[model samples]
Target chain A: MQDVTITINGDIVTGTIDERTLLLDFIRDVAGKTGTHNGCLEARCGCCSVEVEGDIVKSCNVLALQVAGRSVTTIEGLSKERLRPVEHVTSQSLAGMYAPLEAMGADVNDLHPVQVAFHQCHALQCGFCTPGMVMVMKNYLEENPEPTRDDVRTAIAGNLCRCTGYQHIVDAGMMAAETMRSQPDNSRPAPARPAHDH
Target chain B: MRAFTYLTPSAPTEVVEMLDAHAPDARVIAGGQNLLLGMKDRSDSPAFLVSLGGVSELEGVRAADSGELVIGAATTYATLARMEFTGWHAEIASVCGNLADRPVRTMGTIGGAACAADPRYDIPALVTGVGASLEVLSAQGVRTIEPSDFFLEGGGTSLQPGDLLTAVRFPATEAFTTVVFEKFRQRVFDAALASTVLALRVGDGVIEDLRLTVGATTPRPTVCVTSTAGLIGQPVDAIEPVLVADAAAIEVLGPETSNDPPHLRYQRELIKSVTRRALIRATAIPRS
Candidate 1:
């Protein structure tokens, strides 16, 4: 066993790992942070991606000891215990636009406009691929306030979503970007914008 | 991957001590991407993996006051790709920049690439194009060897166990030189089926110097310095014909002779194209 010290999300943790232990196994099994899920054990999928020393890298292939003193940021580290609602207007006008699976996943009694657009466009069929898809879309939209369908496609290439055929998902992402950009801050509804809100 | 002992030594003396202690079973890990991949496959396992990352003296990119371009062996390809290069060397830098992906470029270091001597890699031939000489650190201290003289047959280098490649130095040249690199690969960012780099020095409206290098179609890429000598002082009209004639000299040195391998034809075409481009660049720019 080797002693390893690394930051998980925001906490500094130190532990001993077997010589053969991999970082993905340590994070999921030892730390029990399931937010970092596993896909292909090989390097093809980005589901195991985490930021190590500021560079995006696959965790499955990295040995635990390799990051002995490095800072690693996984999906679990993105926010506080409660997400602040940054609601805005134009959340309805673009609801008539392309499909967004995340928006539709929300119940109608508490629907987000992004979800409404997904239902209107029928963006999601089998929701099995939704989590990774939403994360991919969220990551892309955060970087690109405006993206072409091709840009959306390239951003999502490393991710696999056999369900929904991808065309509708691409449409959903573009529509969400347009909606988010056009919205004005005071237009937010007084209620909580569900924690799952994008 | 099997468990292996890891070590990172700060001093060259300590590195030699570790190499002496580990002996033949020791393997140096620069960027674990390739070495660890092999370990994962259970292909070739080492008892120890010594990381050269801690050796600060082996990391640099300096055109020394002597005009020699001295690059530390552990320097990443990305660093070299972004550096200023003139003459025929630009082709080498550009080829390296686009070597693997941007990630691979950032991860893999030149010392590992050259020492691996795998014909599938591009930089080995590029180093030959620049006439760079290598420095290796071992228990015996340091020794220098030119790339051509240092490569072994069957696409491996002359590196021995416990010997760490230290740095590579390219002799200085003034303006009036040019290098053109041409590669033929089936896909973008894929390994080249055939690759060539041509370095030339032009003077008095004629070719004054040349270095011809070809890769990926042989056990180890061969340098055709003989054919290059024929190009010195040759005018533009005779340069192209000389290259075409030199193609006959580039035959695989080992057992895989099948009338005409696609690799061989592609190799010749790469030589022709790179040479043609390098000549055009050299005469136009005038690198001394």
Candidate 2:
């Protein structure tokens, strides 16, 4: 066993995991953050994506011990702190890049622009791949804030959804881009580190 | 996966010592992108995994004083893609950027990719195509292997059990040369069904020097040295499709030695087309 202390979802957690333990298993089983799902352990499905050191990586392809002393953000960490007081002024407290989603009330309130667009555009069928898709778009839009339909298609190519046929997802991403760019600078939360989850 | 002891050695010497101690039972894991999958599948059951995470020295890309480009073996593809390369190196960056998906690029290292030597991979062809040499270190000492000799006939490299690949060095490309990598895959992120790296040089209006490497469809990346020599002195636009087809057929695909004649024929045809397209695209724009 190797000792690993990692920062996950703004909390520091330490665990002694087997050398063979994958980061995806560590996040789900040891850290008890099951928001990062595992679709294909072989790193193809992109369901096990997470942010480590400001880049999104397939956690299943990474060893748990490799991320020792690093900060990892799973899907659970991608939202603003609901536990904090409503008027909490810490703008940077959110460990993820989904501020636009939170501002539009994607969680526990009104749907985020991406969520609303997905709902309106009918981007999902089973919703198993929704978390991964949202995570990819959140980071992709930050890099290419004004993406065309082709750009949106290329950005979400890694995250596969069998049911939706991808046309609706592309439409939803394009809609979210317009929604994100049109918002005022202050209305949008500060840009978080670009996530590279799958 | 079977449980094993994982050691993170800080220095390259320490890595060699650990490897010497473990020898045949040990595996040096840089990124674990491919190794982890192999371990999970029980294909590679190493008793000891020497993780090189703490070895910071083996992680960067630099232009040496001698005008040679030196890239640390452990440098991740994401980092390499972000580098400002000139001439031939830019071709390398383009290929590295296209390897797998964005996340996989973050974790996968050039050294790991080169060492794995999987025929379907892109890096081996890129390095060998650029005429780069690998720097390897072991308990005994350090030595450089030329690109032509570095990759073995089958998968994997000439690296010994205790050896750690330190870096790869490429001599500076001439000003007249421009390199381009072309790959045809089923998807944007999938491994190449057929790939080629072409480093073409034009003098006046004629082809000066050409280095072509055909990958993915071959058992190893085939550098068409003699075949490329045949193209020299011919005008870039005057180079016919028949020349490329004949070269790929004779040099890259040995028609008589193929076990599966039909598949070999299809691959030869694919190689011919990919090589031609890569050459055209590479020559279309002259490097400044």
Candidate 3:
């Protein structure tokens, strides 16, 4: 067993797990955060996607022991920030990113724009792939606030959705992009993340 | 997946010592994209898994005194994609960015991909095309292996049992050159059926130096020396992508001793078309 400490959902958590425990298992079992679903167990399905050190990764592929001293963000934490819409935050705070959602007329009371766009565009049929898609797009749209339809397709190409034919997902991503870019440049600071997190 | 003990060493020397202590039972894991997949399939079940993530020596891209870009074996493709490189290495960035998807690219390392020696992988051929070499270390000593001698059959490298791949060094190229990589897959994230990497230098309207490598058609990254030789002395105006493609395809698929003739024939056709497309795209890049 290895003693590991990881920051999840902006809180530091520590645990001792088998060397072979995968991050997906640690998130679902140890952290009791089942929002990050596991579909293929393998990395092929994007359902296990999460943010590790500010980059999107498949939790299933990363061993729990490898995530020591790193920061991880699951769908649960991401959805919370989106729902709460933290307006005042540090330059690197992940929570501060949602300020643009307000500029795009995203309702703090309802689902995030990416989520709202998904529902409005019918991006999800069974909803199993929605969390991964949202996680991927949240990170993607933040980086590329103005994405073309082809750009959105390329961004989510890794995520495999067996339903909705991906046409709706692409549409939702573009719609989210429109709302994300509506904010003035001065209104947004650097991405809300700690400089040392990555 | 079978349970295995994990060991994380902070230095390369420690890694080799641990490898020496645990011979065939130890497996060095960087990124774990390929190694973990093999482990999951029960094809590889090492008693001890050595994680290279903690080794600071094997973790960044730097320039060597010899003007070669030494990329630490553990440097992720996601990092490589974000690097600002000019000329031929730009092609490398493009290849790294487009390989698999964002998640895999973020996790897969160039060293891991090269050491895995998967015939269908992009880095092996990309590194080979740019004349890169591997720096390997073990209990015995250290040595540099060229791309031609590095890759082994059946998704393995020349790395001996106790050896660790430290870094891959890419030699700097001349100006007036362009490199391009093209991969053909059924889907965006699927493995390549055939892949091509081309590095061409044209000067004074004449072809100067060219390195063309094709992957996924064979057990290793196949350098099209014969095809390259055909274009070396030719003028840029007289050269054609099809001419080089045909030579590369013929060289890859010899007419002798066929165990699986039909598969070889189909692959040969893929080699030609992919090579031609790669060459055309490469030659079209505006010379800087």
Candidate 4:
């Protein structure tokens, strides 16, 4: 066993974990941040993707002890407010059941551009893969402010989403790129477009 | 994953000392993208893991006085991709950036891939194709091993239990005029089913030197020196890619047998096609 301390979303999370403990487990179990989903324990699935010192990595593939004193940002860190959980959001009642970012108490300005774009474009269906997709997209858009459709596709190739067919996710990525490009200084969030009525 | 002791050493010498102390049961972790995966599956259960993350000396790229390029063992692929490389060395950057996904590239190091010695991985083949050497440090001393000797015959490395690979040294940039690497995979992020690396120098439109290496098909990346020997001194246009590729495939795979498995046959075909493509692409580049 080893004492590992890591900064998750600006909060210091220290745990006495086994040397074999994965960063994924450290985040979810120790830090209590379940936004970072656990998909395939293998690195093939990017559901465990998180930012370590501003660079994205599959947390599952990394050991907690390897990043003992590093700062990590998970899906929870992307925005100031969390959306209220909706057990089952079907297309029939999606409009009524899903509330807009503002209505859900999430400040539109606090959410990352990628998150805003995902909400606007309905990029997520079941939303199981949203955290990883959003994290990867946010990181990719920062590096490449002007990515083409194919570039967005390639950037998120590691992240898998069985739902939404990836068409809307790609659209959200392109939209987010435009928003990021327009704002040279991303300190302020992109203006929230009118929410999806349907 | 089994419980183990983790050691973080800041210097190469310290890493070797830790490995020396643990010997046989201790393993050095660089990037740990592949090592951790193996550990999770219980395929590898090292009692001690010596991490090279804090070793500043073993990170970044430097040029040796001999003009060879020395890349630190812990330098990640993302760093290589972002670097501005000149001439044929840019091929290395391209290969580094394109293979694997974005997140994996951020953490996967070239030295780690080479040490892992997985045939499906691209680094070993590219290193061998470019005629690079691996520098290793152990309690005994530091030594450089050529790729031919560094990589074992059947999908493993020749590194001993106490050995820690410190860096990969590439031949002088002037050695190869141009290099082209080609591979075939099922998906965008899948490892290469078969990959080929072709490096050559042409003087006045005639082949001066050529090196062809076929990877993934063989247990280790095999350099086709004899098969490509006939191409030397031949005009660039006179070389037939298909014929050269056929000779290389046969040389690497041996004569096709009726009892060969279906995957073996497929690999042979992949080897030929990728090698042929690499040759065509390499010859088409305008020589300075």
Candidate 5:
């Protein structure tokens, strides 16, 4: 066992964990951030993706101790305000459900453009893969701001989405790229919130 | 994953000592992209994990005084992909960026891939085809192993428990005027089922040096040295890709057997196709 101190979404999470504890478990169990999903225990699924020292890696494939003293940014760190959970966001009402971001007091500016694009493009159906897709797309766009649609498709090739057939996801990626290119200063997510002392 | 003790050594020599002290029970974890997966499945459960991430000497790429490209074992695929390389060396970057996915590449190291020595991985094939050497450090001190000896016949590597692969050294670009790697996989992110690499050097309109390697289909990357040696002095334009590929396929797969499995036959076909493609591309490219 080892004591790992990781800065997660701007929060310093310290835990004495088994040496085999994965970063996915460290984030969801230790850091209490469920925004990062645990789709596959193996590295095949991208659901466990998160940023470590500015590079995205599948958290499930990394031991928590491997990143003992590093800073990690999860989906939760992508915005200033978290969108309040709506009971059921149906496709029929999805068009009318733009108020959740506003109702949660999150302006369009507060959320990462990728998140906004995913919502606008209806990029997700089950939403199990949305967080990973958004994280990867955001990371990819930051590097290649002028990516073509084919480039966006190739960028998210590792991320699997059973629903939406990936067409809308690719559309969202292109939209996000255009949005990011227009606003260079907003390329990276806003500085993470200050750590909450526990 | 079974519980283990995680050890982080900041220097290459320190890692060697740690591995030496804990031989047979300790395993080095570079990117953990491959090791952690095995651990999760209980296929690998070492008592200790020596992480090479913090080891400064085992990271990054540099040009050796001898003009060889020395790539630190811990350098991630993301670093190699984003780098700007010149001439045929750029194919290394291309292979790095194009494999797996962005996130996996960010954490997978070339050394880890070589150390893992998985048959389906592209690194072993490319390294073997280019005749690169592996730098290994053990209790006895550092020594270089040729790719032919470093990689085993079937799967896995020749590295021992106490051995740490420090870097992979590629011959100078002038050694191989052009290099091409081709592979076939069902999905973009899937490991190659069959892969081929062709590294060629031409001088005075004749083939001076030719190295053709077939991987994935074989248990280990097999260099068709005897089969390709015949093409060394052949005129560059007279070399027929189909004839060369057929010879290489036969060399690696051996003579067709009456009861050869359907998959074996399919793999032979794949080897022929990818090899043909690589040879065609290698011959057509304008040599520097």
Candidate 6:
């Protein structure tokens, strides 16, 4: 087993992983954190995306050893019972996109605002693409809180959904942003993360 | 993917020994943004991987004593984005910061990107415009190479098996120039279909120095500075034709083998667009 130290959900977790283990696999099998799911091994699907040191990257595309000293933030950290409003928007984006409210096989209930908007707009029919959609929305919104129509389309362009034509997905993003504005806390940072030293 | 031995060296020199010892069978992983992705798909896997992250000397950016900006091979795009500025700093920073997204750039390194020499990558052209050179260390010792000579005609560099790119340095000058980068990609970060970067030094309604580098259109990024030999003191208006002539010169150097004829046509257009705009932007800036 190879020793690897990676910060997960604001707290650094050290573990021993197989030599060829992937970051997503370690995060799921050994780390016991199921927020990032493994769908397609290729990065074509965005279900494996997680925030690593403030940057949202596809966890599946990286090896666990690569992140040996880096920090990663998964959806598991954003607890509905213990998160701020922006966290709420994030959870809403995830929950709104699917039926059981999960993506990449990781399940969660605290909906990101974008998720809620997706649901309100009836964005998905099969729900296979919601989690990826939610993740994309969360990152896009973080970069551009108020995105244009082109921005919204470009954000979701990589996500393939045969169920819905994607008009609802676009509407959902704007709607989530609008709805979250009604709640003042959504503009705030997720929460005071537990200090994790580099 | 097949399991393999992983080695993280603490020094750049050690990195060379490791790559050489393993030779042809081991992969030097910097950033791992592309290499890891390829491994994940089982497309290619080296028997061993030499992670360069532990080589601290290859991870920072600073201005050299000679006024050249030096970028370590392992310097991440995120770090380069945050690097302190000098004379044409904003243009370089803006282009790099705007690359891929916050995520990919966070792990992508300038050396890796430059060495990978992916046609879509902007650093090749960015550095070429600035007249940058790279510090490469092998078992033989260290050798510095200009951007023009570093990139080969196959979408990658001419890096020998054990040659580790140490840093990239550019001659610092107060020439306030005009530079513009334009790219056409299928998606936000899905590699480039065509991209171009043009940088020019202008003054007193006359052209001083200009560098136009086009990526994706050719196997490796190529600089069209042939006409720069003639534009030393030519008027700004007269420089456009010279720049066009330079672009034509580039089109004739290396045959486009990475793609078919139709695709080459699109890339040629991008080279033209960026060449034209770069000239316009440089003219707009006040001469220093």
DockQ of 3: 0.59
lDDT of each: 0.64, 0.79, 0.80, 0.89, 0.87, 0.69
| Candidate 3: C-alpha lDDT | 0.80
Q: Give the per-residue lDDT digits (tens) of candidate 3, residues B1-288.
A: 788889989999999999989998999988998888888888989999899989978988887777678899999999999888866767767788888888888889989999888888888888877778899998888899988788875556788889999999887756328887887887788878888888878877578878888888888888888777767777765667888888888887665356657877778878889999988887766432
lDDT of 6 at A7: 81
| DockQ for candidate 2 | 0.56
lDDT of 4: 0.89
True contacts kept of each: 0.10, 0.67, 0.71, 0.86, 0.90, 0.47
Tens digits of per-residue lDDT, candidate 2, B42-153, equal 9989999898899999999888887888999999998898888887778778788877887788889999999998877999888877788899999879999997678887
Top DockQ model: 4
Model 3 chain A lDDT-worst window of ten: A189-198
Question: For residues A12-114, could you state the per-residue lDDT of candidate 4 as single tens digits?
Answer: 9999888888999999999999989999999887999999998999999998887889999999988765556555554456656556454545576877888
Q: Extract clashing residue pairs from model 3.
A: A92-A192, A92-A193, A93-A192, A93-A193, A94-A192
- Residues A67-169, model 1: lDDT tens digits: 6677876665543332223253244633554433233333332433343345445566654344345555555565577889977776666556666777787
Alpha carbon lDDT at A118, candidate 4: 93
Candidate 2: give the TM-score of chain A. Answer: 0.74
- The parts of candidate 1 lying over 4 Å away from their true place are A31-49, A58-61, A75-198, B84-93, B173-176, B226-229, B241-258, B261-288
Q: By TM-score, how accurate is candidate 2?
A: 0.88
Arrange candidates by DockQ, descending: 4, 5, 3, 2, 6, 1
Q: DockQ numbers for every candidate?
A: 0.19, 0.56, 0.59, 0.83, 0.74, 0.36
**RMSD in angstroms between candidate 1 and the native structure over all alpha carbons:** 7.5
- The stretch of ten residues in a row with the least summed lDDT in candidate 4 chain B is B279-288
Q: Candidate 6 has what TM-score?
A: 0.80
Better of 2 and 5 by DockQ: 5
How much is B45 displaced in model 4, in angstroms?
Answer: 0.5
lDDT of 1 by residue, B1-288 (tens): 777887878766677678779988888877655666678787868888777767777776777797877888888776677777765445646776766543345456788888778787887877876678998888888999988777876668888887888888877766226676666676444677766666766666677776767777676777765555666778634566445434523533332356867755556666555555555554455533
Instruction: Give the lDDT of residue B235 in candidate 2.
Output: 80
